[model samples]
Target: MTQATNDQFLLAARPVGMPKDSDWQRATPALAELADGEVRVKILYISLDPAMRGWMNDARSYVRPVAIGEVMRAGGVGVVVESKSPKFAVGAHVMGVMGVQRYWQGPAEDKGAMLAQVDPAIAPLPAWLNALGMPGMTAYFGLIEVGQPKAGETVVVSGAAGAVGMTVGQVAKHLGCRVVGIAGGEDKCRFVVEELGFDACIDYKAGPVHAGLKQHCPQGVDVYFDNVGGEILDAVLTRINMKARIVICGAISQYNATEAVKGPANYLALLVNRARMEGMLVTDYAARYPEGVATLARWMKEGSFKNREHIVEGFETFPSTLNMLFKGENLGKLVLKVADA
Candidate 1:
């Protein structure tokens, strides 16, 4: 790859299904000089999330979609190399929607709405982007606020070994719930139970998720933190307890589908069991991020929580590395190391 002054990926065209290389164009754009209350950051690590897939489409969502000819939107952690803002000083490490770029220049308040200073001393930079960042916030709020599992209740989560799911199962266990995870393979299922401390994990690859859930959860599911919607969601619906709370986090399984997202066939199960399934977008809980990060950070210090990140080296690898999430090649949160922090 040729060296550029400042590298960035811009959407060249809206993708039809899975994004292709042709969908984006890499450019070396010149940086703008900062304005008052503005700061410039050198991006260190860029977060690779399943949600980025939805952002590629020009659709109205909880947040505005990434537009054609615009920098592909992403969350990242960086250091304020230049600052004209009272909120942040030069050398301060910050995390925000910095997009897929080598450098970001903007008003502090504009980026800081979903941003916070990251202390590398407390946790490594990558860990911040993993457990203490957006993924952690999503799992924390989605499970605690939306799923609402109680002690002795059975909590089931799909995508149970990915970034959000890994945290959800651990949090539910900490709250005294019987936690069961649904993962794609034996290795992932094993990792969830043996490493992340879930009570049980059903291997969706081994058999039908409904059958596995029956064997694992003997008691009906009280809360379901759903990350991968599709057949797994419909399977979970079959065994929900009355008043079960379903936290709709993401649907990675259907992100690349050429057709519309698959609606749960057993949705009447929500009606039958009087359960409620509510969608969750992490940014809505931004106000409480400090509270979530503080507790999650403490849990990490005490070793009650585990954080995993599959670090793909090089900023140039974004185009190919992103497909890892859809292919289930990444174990936990997928992150791209853009440069040294």
Candidate 2:
């Protein structure tokens, strides 16, 4: 039996550097009676990403910041307990902007915008938010469209063992590129190379990243998919081949900086080598998502892609669990389990 009252974390304050407990206000919002075209959902899992940290700030970006007094924005998976829409069936699995709450109610008119039903039969519920979801889609467009990877080329990915990084490396591998992954720990490095089939894995916490790139890609990097910004981006810039492609995805490293975000000092390498660097937003590829999802799903079916998740229990642990992303405490995707399905 689910609770009658809904638990949620609202944006209380704009975080300065790293978010603190004071940044959020927990509350119980009353569940409303179902209206026509609306569906009530019982949230099971919530995605905790480095991007969420950025959303806490008032800075201008791709989307509007989560306003103070509003429900903290989050992506989640849930079961539709009640449906007043012909579009969605009761008991159907759905994923969307379900927020940091145990329950969510939205309309069918908002499907594919705020809510969309997903098929659990295709993959596990978590995979819909991981390999088969945003992370996979981000990698597909960022690497293939922006990075333009070619066979036999040496491709490098910062945060390689992460959800988006893992997918980018594997997809580049599938395209016949030699893939190098930059991660934090030896365990993450080992798993990416041994299990995810990356050609090399660099432990950024161990030493300077340039040395790792030099050792792993002596021929020079061809396509660099950057997830962490700052120094790592500078390091990769210094090693790019002529006409090389660099794709800017997310920058987890600079998300919590008190100072202004730093641009790569070695950006001049782009001019010297005639290389190109471009930024991308996942939403920009919305129309082609079906094409991308189908391709990733097929690869998953073939055992070439690894679907990994780091799940933390308890919806009440949202604040602490979210901080895990910045500390590199989580391997692969970070998900908060709100409740049992």
Candidate 3:
């Protein structure tokens, strides 16, 4: 076969607030031949997540910051075109931390790469990046393991129309809980309620979240799966049930703040309610990904769950496409399609 040219976006600089095109340096590097235990993959879809903004910061966090000149960190689904590893064969479809690139060439057991083969028959390739990918795992584990909602309880999820929030509400509904979503705009709220089958979705842009919660979650929130923190978290804290569980999944609202990230001002409510708030990193449950994948995929197949993706085509649209997340422009999971399966 002829040699492949790899186009990738490297971290050029860390931004103080929202990242811009200047923060990334695009480069086309010559692909190297696959060595033993290595494979070359043609990345198909790259996941656009809110957590990516945090990764661009220089400060310490769950994972190290994306180093300058290194490939911008991202999770993607791809197809293996060449393989020198027994674990992966040629023509296999896989997903991993392939980054904002056209291809991923790496060792089979590279922990940072986190490579794994995926089946399209189970769900479409983009769905693998949505419901069967990191976002789904984040929603499943964050809600089930951290939020710990019981049947007949009230569960509230911020960023309700986004990837993690959508899955969190759906999973809560499947477990027989009353699910309420908090999102911006009327259309997103409608999608969360009508399309995703949430009990109700509060349009934060239209009115106060506290009023919405009082109207929809009359019983008080037993479990709150927080994705977009800040004011929304403070609003939910005021209405949490006694001994409630609050899951800190992501804080998209504060990710692009130029100043210090805002903390929930109503945190004292947690103490008054005897509630607990805990943060979760999806990678923390990597060993049990199969459990989350199996459960979510089965629900998808059984017609009880649905996965949606807003795919922006083109390899060069990564920067603008990524900004869509913070702008509340995309419905469901936002992904960038670089190649066909």
Q: TM-score: which candidate is best? A: 3
List ranges where model 3 is wrong by over 4 Å: none
Q: Candidate 2: minimum summed lDDT over ten consecutive residues — where?
A: 108-117
- lDDT by residue (167-273, candidate 3, tens digit) is 99999999999999999999899999999999999999999999999999999999999998899999999999999999999889999999888999999988899
Candidate 2 is scored at a TM of 0.98
Q: After superposition, how far is residue 338 of candidate 3 from its true place, in Å?
A: 0.3
lDDT of 1 by residue, 240-260 (tens): 999999999999999999998
lDDT of 2 by residue, 1-341 (tens): 54678999999999988899999999998888888999888999998877898778887988888899988888999998988999788899988987898888878667444677788878899998887788888999899999999899999999988899999999999999999999999999998999999999999999999999999998899999999999999999989999999998988999989998998999999999999999999889989988988898888888988789989999999999999988898888999998888
Which regions of candidate 2 are displaced past 4 Å?
A: 111-113
Candidates' C-alpha lDDT? 0.89, 0.90, 0.93
Worst 10 residues of 1 by lDDT: 1-10
Clash totals for all models, in order? 0, 0, 0
Between prediction 2 and prediction 3, the one with superior lDDT is: 3
Structural similarity to truth (TM-score) of each candidate: 0.96, 0.98, 0.98
What is model 2's C-alpha RMSD? Answer: 1.2
- The true-versus-predicted C-alpha distance at residue 87 of model 1, in Å, is 2.6
Order of all candidates by lDDT, from best down to worst?
A: 3, 2, 1
Candidates in order: C-alpha RMSD to true structure: 2.2, 1.2, 0.9
